[model samples]
Structures are given as structure tokens and as C-alpha cells.
Target: MKPSLYIATALMLASTSGFAQRPPAISSPDVHADNTVTFKYYSRTAQKVSLSGEFLSGNHAMTKDTSGIWSITVGPVKPDIYPYAFVVDSVPVADPNNTYIFANERFKRSIVDIPGNTPLVHALQKVPHGKVSYRLYPSKTLGTTRQLLVYTPPGFNPAGKTKYPVLYLIHGGSDTEETWTKVGRANFIADNLIAQKKAVPMIIVMPYGNVRPAPMPDFTKEVMQDIIPFIEANYPVLADPQHRAVAGFSVGGGQTLNIGLTNTSKFAYVSSYAPYTQTEEFQKNFGATYAPNAEQVNKQLKLFTISVGTDDFLYESVKQNIAMFTAKGIRLRSDIVPGGHTWMNCKQYLATTLQGIFK
Candidate 1:
């Protein structure tokens, strides 16, 4: 009850609490000057921990230390945004120490941005950046409330009279509207291109492109009906075919070929990256319409591009697609690169396609 005695007791308790056991320190993701990144996962009870990502060879087994920390050093990775995760005891998990995250398709992962000596096309350069926003709209065809990620280019003012061109960018199978921006880094690519004045400042709209198992209404219905109407009414964008473009990867690439080719009057620029479609399915679906609309479609469409990697699963089919359509008295542009059906190639395809679209 005495003041001095109570103060001494409080000090002793504070010392005990301060000296109480504390969490161990972490030395994860040690970035070296040579660009090699070493990642560490400390777990005293885990049986196994491995690292896999946009970097490294598939999955690399990390070495465990005496202190129960698993670690691996990979790359000299080229300066780019890479997503990686640590698999602990057969469960895939993001690194807890990393603050940057890129999530899509309902799965979240950690990201690391390695800066290059000079800015890459996909790099986020020091320039006026754009704004990415989410707009939830009612999809009457799908009978669901769908979300779309819209990117307005740098210096975009909705009130101003400057109306920008629009690009309806679509995502692949098992991916959502957010995939293009989050994982593909489409916004930064667009920002860099616009800053360099290689591509025009345009409004990019990324929409979900999965409507599957057949007999179901194709997503093209929603794309043509709900999404276009919403973007046109809300944003300061050009509303004509001359200022509109459509592009996607994988399944979305197929949709691009189907919708953009079939509705050529609506989209002047169309690009498909590693589009997945069987010849039989293509014939059953778009063949009849393609033959009849050939002249009109060709007349209306300014640019029609198809790109696929050499190692892509859809490579042969895409080549056949290019050949089949070209033989159908249609003009086509095909870009075959050196990679597989991965996001790495998709990003490059996007960058190249953007530079050519509005020009």
C-alpha cells in the first residue's frame, strides 16, 4: 500500500514480463546485389517445406537449418514482378514476411518486384499512373452479380471531354477479371506504353470469361450486353468500333475469336493469345457464321491477331486456326513466340498487342 514499495513491485513485474520468452527472428528473402533471392521459412514442427513460383525450377527443396528454418536462393531473376509461395507439409502458403500479394481465381499468393537496371515493358515505371476500380453489375444472362476490373489510363478525367479508346481484356479459364491486373500486370504495361506514347491512353476493362460445361449461355452474351453497356454509360470512352478492341488468353482467347470475329462491327481490333479450341468445336460453332459474314466482318475489323507460344498446348491448334481462317478468305495476324501456355508468355503477348491495337 506504500507508494515506494508498490513502485518497486511494479518495476520487478515489468522486468519479468519484458524478459519473458519472445518470438524468434526471421532472415527470409535475402535479396542479393547479384539479384539472387534467398527465402527462409522457420517452422520448428514442419516435416517439409519447398519453394515454387514464377521463379525457380518447378519446385525447389529448401535446406533446413539446425534452428528449423528452411531456405533456398534462386535467380539472378530478370527484373519483373514474380509470385511465389512456400509449400509447408503439403499445403501451399504465401510467405508471411512479404507484404506484396497478387491474388486471383480465389487463391492468394505473395509477390516480389525485382527492379531492373532499366525499366522493362512490364515494369512499373516512374510516370503518371492509372486508376484501377471495381464495378459490380447485374449479369442478366448469367443471372448473377458479376464484378469487372476497369482501368482508366493516366490523366483520365471523367468530367473532361477527352474520350479514350476502350480495350475489353479477358482472362483465361479458372481466372477472374482481376487476373489480368493482379497477376499479369496489365495496368503497369498499359501505363508504361502510354507514358512512352507507343500506345494511346485507353480504358481497359477486364471481365470474367468463364461460362462453361456447354448448353449454358456463352459469356459473350454478357460481354456484348451487360459489360459494354455499363462501361460505355459510366466511363468517358469512345463508343464506336473504330475505338474498341478485344483480347484474351486461353479459353478467353477462344471467346475473343468467337465474339470479336463474329461481331466484327463492334470490335475493330481483336487479339487471341493461345486460344484453346478444337477444330470440330470451332467448325460446329463459328463455321457457318464465318462463311456468311466473311466480307462484312473483314471490312469492319481493322486488325485481327492470334498469338501462341511454340511450346503451348494450343500451339498446333492455333496454327491450324490461323491457317483455316486465312484459307477462309479472312486476313489474320499470327504471333508465335518461344514459351509455353503460361502467364509469362501471356504478359508479353499483352504488351505487344497493346502497342498495335489503337494504332
Candidate 2:
């Protein structure tokens, strides 16, 4: 064969050989019958890969096959939504093959939901789903345009005569206004609850809880002034204390206590889930002021509740707040359940609060 023939043969082989072939199939988070799941990642160059998530007992090393694909099948993960990531050689990254992801400012994670055979609280069902509206309005308090997410329950019609109560649900730190309905499944929960007649149809208001130029913004001021007024003016809501509730998780939880408790005349039902508070600061400022007004708050408050996980870092601090309020002769309801400051427990607390509120 001449040199030209040889060159043509080499080019044909390069085009048709392994370089053009498709790699092996990767089945990430492959669910099994016994409630186990197999997570797989294809990485030919990585020296190590470890799986880290709420499902495992810390970082678990993945086993590599002959094809250099790292994998791990963890047994019997509980039926819930979990966020996981792969730390390939110490750098964390979401599963490239997985599209479901959770939001976080510092870390990226791939979300997996091990749904029960039946529909869970976060799972979608045949029930009538509510409407989620992303509303934008100018915040006079902050001097900026802000976004808020609102959930209107099934059959909610502003033009009709029926007016529903409102729940101002706040999101956690590192989450945007969309977190509650998008990740926490707030609309689905509301839909399911209303369908079963377990919860009254209501409007859920989710606001952007953060502001610039401070350790924190005057969220209480913004919500009380801007967000509430916007909702009342536009939506078919019973814009009164008896029909208004406030609840939140994490930083939003702290805001809930600070704003809702102080304005007892405005919010009838007030609750917090895994609230983060600096005990010393709370005692120095809020505690002293609110302790004196405990009677009025207790009188006007239809439901005053705090729910925290036993294993949460803020558990003891939350207990301290509760103790202070208890000493002030304020009626307080507590849900000290298992888990930590996580969405798993947030959902439980929200479910419980919805059942008992506005009844």
C-alpha cells in the first residue's frame, strides 16, 4: 500500500474506533425494590469519588468498576427528599446525569426524592393544585424592587365574595423567594390538605427576607408595610388579624418571632421552625421589650408556636427563648421532634401548623 492509502486507512480507523463510540450507560440513583438506591458517576480521570448526603453516615467512598465508573448503592434510604453531591478528589459537584437539584449559595447538590409508594407531602397527586404567582413590587422600606411568591389555594377567586385567610410563609437563609414553593413543595402541601379538608384554603405569601447594608434588614417593616399591603390590595384575602398568620424557617423563623410577636394585633397565628437566634442579643433587646407586653400578645395571639428539631444546633437557643417567654406567662406550644435544621423537619412543622391554624 502506498503512503496515501495508509493515511486514508488511519483516518477511517480514527473516525470509526473508540473515539466515536458511546460510553457505557450510567444509571444514577437507581431505585430498588428494598428501598435501596445505586448512584453512579462516570469519571475516567478522577483519583477518588465519595458520596456525601443526608442519606449516609457522612462521606462514603464509592467503588470503582473496571470501566473507571464510580458507584455506590446505599441501602434503604428513608422515604423523603434528600440533597446529595459527589466529591471527586475533594471538589464537590452535582451529578452531571441528574437534573433535579436543590439551591444553596455555597454548595451545589443533586436532589433525590425517595417517594413512598403512596404520594408523600411533597409529592404530586390527582388533587386540585393551587396557583403560584411571582409578584414584583417596589419596597418603600428598602427603596428597591422586590419579589414575592404567593400561593393561592384551590378555588381561590379574588372576584368572588369568598375571602380566605393568609399565611405569610418565609424561606430559610441562602434561599430565594421561590424556595418555599419550588423546593419545599408548599403549593402541593396546600392542595393536598385542602382536598382532604384538613386545612382551610388560604393564601401563602413568601417574600425575599434579606436586605442590603446590615447584618439583617428590617424585614418586619418591609413585610408589614409593603408585602402585606400588596397582597391585601390585589388578592381576595381577609386582611385582618384574625385571618392572618406568619411562619418561617431558619433566619425567617427568627424574623417570624420578632415581627409576629411584636405585632400581635396584626398576626393571629405565629410559628417558627428551627429558628436561628443569638440568645444573648435576643435577651438583651427583644426579650426585655416583649416580656413586658407578654399579656397583650398572649391575649391577641390565637396560636403561638415554636417547632425545632432535637438535634438542631439552634435547639438549645430556641429552648432558651421558649423558657424566657414561658417565664413571661406567654402560652407557648412546642414541637421538639427528631432531626436537624433541615427541610425534612420544616415540612413536618409546616404541616402541623397548617392543621391547627385558623380553625
Q: What's the TM-score of every candidate structure?
A: 0.87, 0.89
lDDT of all the models against the reference?
Answer: 0.83, 0.84
lDDT of 2: 0.84
lDDT, residue 307, model 2? 94
Q: Could you give candidate 2's per-residue lDDT for residues 1-359 as a string of tens digits?
A: 56675467557756785675334556688878777888998888899999998877789899899998899989798888787899999899998778777755656788887886877877888999889998899899988898898899887777999998999998887777877876688888888888989999999998888654331337888888898999899998888899999999998888788778878999899998988777454445575657789789889999999999998999998998788789889998988999988887877888888888899
| Candidate No. with top TM-score | 2
Question: How many clashing pairs in candidate 1?
Answer: 0
Name the regions of candidate 1 deviating beyond 4 angstroms: 1-30, 106-109, 214-217, 279-283
Model 2 residue 176 CA deviation (Å) reads 1.8
CA displacement after TM-score superposition, residue 114 of candidate 1 (Å): 2.7
In model 2, pairs of residues that clash are none
Worst window of 10 by summed lDDT in candidate 2: 210-219
Candidate 2, superposed: residue stretches over 4 Å from native? 1-27, 213-217, 279-281
